[model samples]
Target: MAAPFSAVPTPFRVRAADRWWYGNCAWDAFGICAALHVDGHIETVCADCREPIVVEVRDERPDDQRLLFHCLVPAARWWADIVFT
Candidate 1:
């Protein structure tokens, strides 16, 4: 596990399309889950995925507002790359 607190901040938001791959299997999901865990906002990320194609995440927690402000921002370019490659 990473240290409880690190000198640098972790990226709270990441695009699904940035990580998405066609024919993605269990391994891919597991890898994504691990990455999300390190991000510290795991529950919100997972919850956003349960919806349709469009997903958004907004910070509801009062204390760590900065850390919680995240959304599954669309990565259209990444998705295009996945399709082309």
Candidate 2:
């Protein structure tokens, strides 16, 4: 008799372009931080900032892929809006 089936694993992996997009988003966020510092929007910037202030807590966890992408996207958009608009 054939063996019983188990839960199937995903056959495919994420594409290179997706990975690149995430990394690019992160870089854009870092750029936004610099822009905020320059543009005298320090208070609003603090509200938008995602970098953890508590050093130990920040260091304890390994990076999360989704959260990292989220952290980058809005911040980059914020800066881009400031510069171009």
lDDT of 2 by residue, 1-85 (tens): 0111113222111122112111123233233333333221111112256443211112222134233323433654765664342
Candidate 2: C-alpha RMSD after superposition: 19.0
Candidate 1 C-alpha lDDT tens digits along 29-81: 22343444422122222344553222232232223334332324344553455
What Cα-based lDDT does every candidate model obtain?
0.31, 0.25
The lDDT leader among the candidates is 1
Decoy 1 TM-score against native: 0.18
Q: What's the C-alpha lDDT at position 81 in model 2?
A: 60
